[model samples]
Target: MSIEHMEQMETLLPEWLETSRLRTGQGEVASYIPELAKAARDTLGVFVADSQGKTIAAGDYGIPFTMQSISKVFTLILALMDHGEEAVFYNVGKEPTGDDFNSMIKLELVEPGIPFNPLINAGAITVSSLIAGDSPEDKSQRILQFFRKLAGNDGLDYNMDVYHSELETGDLNRSLAYFLKQNGVLKDPVEDVLSVYFKHCSIEVNCADLSRMALVLAFDGVDPCNGEKLIPRRYVQIAKTFMVTCGMYNASGEFAIDVGIPAKSGVSGGILALVPGQYGIGVVGPSLNSKGNSTAGVHLLERLSKEFSWSLF
Candidate 1:
């Protein structure tokens, strides 16, 4: 971002955050996971970072939250890096399901039976099974290390409370894994795959951590700060394309029209977004809309995209 743009954001983000926070009442904290319900319903936060490492933060930006479904983006990239495109795509399709991220109805009804995309719960579980590892523990460790590297924060770790909560309450995810196994889609045992999947979802991060991670994607897998390549550009292209199409659950189309950027939102009310070649953004609003996205976070991003013309479309 330019100096003038940074100054403008510093001046406007606070006011915009307050304005967006009012939308919290229109949504509710995610309760199915149980632990996520503990987040303050009215809290909202954001952090914006540029390639030069300059940053602006607002609201409850220091608060921590789990990555939730947002972890799927990286897991998918890891799977691609591990097995290449043909092997990865053999396990999952490229189109959006248009169904809820967790729904398994299409697995039975849809022909061929693989998940339509990896951002959804079913596909992520499948991707988790594809990670190259000798055991579930090894796979989870690799995922955590990859995420820490991308975020430039070795301290990044799981919220054990959230991990246990999701593991205990993830009956639906287990069912999906079992179905995939039955369909010959998953080679690993069901619990083994869920072990990796839930651990990655429970990985904890704050807005700043999320912004740094998004910054890597913004620069097409290169960490611009130190000029190091973290992921292949082709894999980054595939990941960003998935982010634009299926990152927001079933509300992705609406988000694309309104925010016009590649973004992935998690049930913990975290949104990871990037203005390609320009800025990376992180937002958190524990209050969630019906579509399982952060209510105020989406609103804030829409406003920022319009104010700054950051949309890719």
Candidate 2:
């Protein structure tokens, strides 16, 4: 079944990409980050990789971009591995807040005061504090190493241009870290945690890298490409649930309905999605919709999901 689906995808992807690329004009490139504004607004790309390491690609799939918030999913798993579920859950909640991913409104409104889920900025920041490392530098290096293993690409490294830009102008994120610190939710120093957070977000990858990483999650944490268990099955289950509930920020519900898959979207216009037990997909369309998702990328996923009956629900 999976082989047949991959074959069908190879046959049909080009046509689908062309149609989806038309939606790029309806959106705008994110400029608040300064560095992200430089991405080609009209560009659209996608890559799909199966467990066997085979891939089918289209459009600008080779273009490398920062992982952005997509790094949170893996960091959440790393936190779980470091501190265990009980400890990790105490610092982060499991529900979705309809608010923006970067919003701090819910932190004060809600009891226990943790971020709604690990995918959001607040929760991810808290998770960064939980990483088992001696210093911020050490933690960041560990995260890079882990990501490289999952992607099977040793060349993966930080896009320092984006990293320095975000670090310089990330006042809002710094505010969130201070708030978490005030609430006693963040154990590490605010700057230290933020450094780790920003460093991970700056890790760079192209579509193929993302697909390879997602393929590990698709197979219940086993990297089918090399038959290595990179994450526990339980951790992947928890991460995937969060992906469905909150990975797309406030637009998660719409994406779940339209694309019907566990997916995560980063502010840099990269989306990492998976068909459980089947395929892993990576998409990039810098032009974003109002909810901060890739406009053309989301449309393309919707088309493919409907055509392939890939929805889990």
Candidate 3:
């Protein structure tokens, strides 16, 4: 992981951001979540945290936004930490569903009702149930602990408004939860599991916080700042494997081809990416492409990976 370091990529990031923002107009913001759609569509930003803990950024990198689906990565890792790998994988899978990120049809089509991968909403909810907890509050605390550990910030908190908003409008997630319950894949009650899942989805952070979290994964679960292991190595493997395979919903394959890095994206246009064993990258652009990935975020990553040769493959 040793490398020459840039004091800050922020000074040069704006030029890179501007060049990559051309695709924002070609895509639409997510309207399903309602609140997510109201974000400034034209906004695009990039933030990077290297192995040295140096921060760099440009554009709307400071914009506050809910983690949305991006939080699933943390929850999946948390569930793995609570339950062993075998227990986690038994309920969810590592392969991509290739359907929309929010597609319920995949749940119906997959036999025995196992989710195609933990990055999807259905899979994430299933993972949420595996946390060692008897109540929703108990389960959520485990997640918060994991997030705080990785983000290196105890101030990270759930946005109750966003959580309630998703709860009020989450018919699809509710239906998926019930489906998992009926199939015997859910460990907790559907409502309880969904509560934890939605709350994780509603965790709020700006791009800088996200890069710190992403950097943990980039460093293989070790927080470079203190050289401490924040996540188990085995569970880190599972989380990143899923990110490479299913992180961007249906656009994962295309992302792999273009960006050549393991990455995750949310409906809020936040993407967490990495060059494993190297540097972690984060991007935000409220507008999303057809597959619910950040439009400019995609372009920015593609160009960054190309310019820096950051592919894991």
Q: Report, for every candidate in turn, its global Cα lDDT versus the true structure.
A: 0.95, 0.93, 0.83
Clashing residue pairs, backbone N/CA/C < 3 A, model 3: none
Which stretches of model 2 miss by more than 4 angstroms? 2-4
Give the alpha carbon lDDT tens digit for every residue of 2-68 in model 1: 6887799999999999999999999999999999999999999999988887899999999999999
What TM-score would each prediction reach against the true structure? 0.99, 0.98, 0.95
TM-score of 1: 0.99
Better of 2 and 3 by TM-score: 2
Model 2 accuracy (lDDT, Cα): 0.93
Q: Which candidate do you rate higher for TM-score, 1 or 3? A: 1
Against the true structure, whose lDDT is highest? 1
Candidate 1: stretches off by over 4 Å: none
Model 3 bad stretches (over 4 Å): 1-11
lDDT of 2 at 283: 96
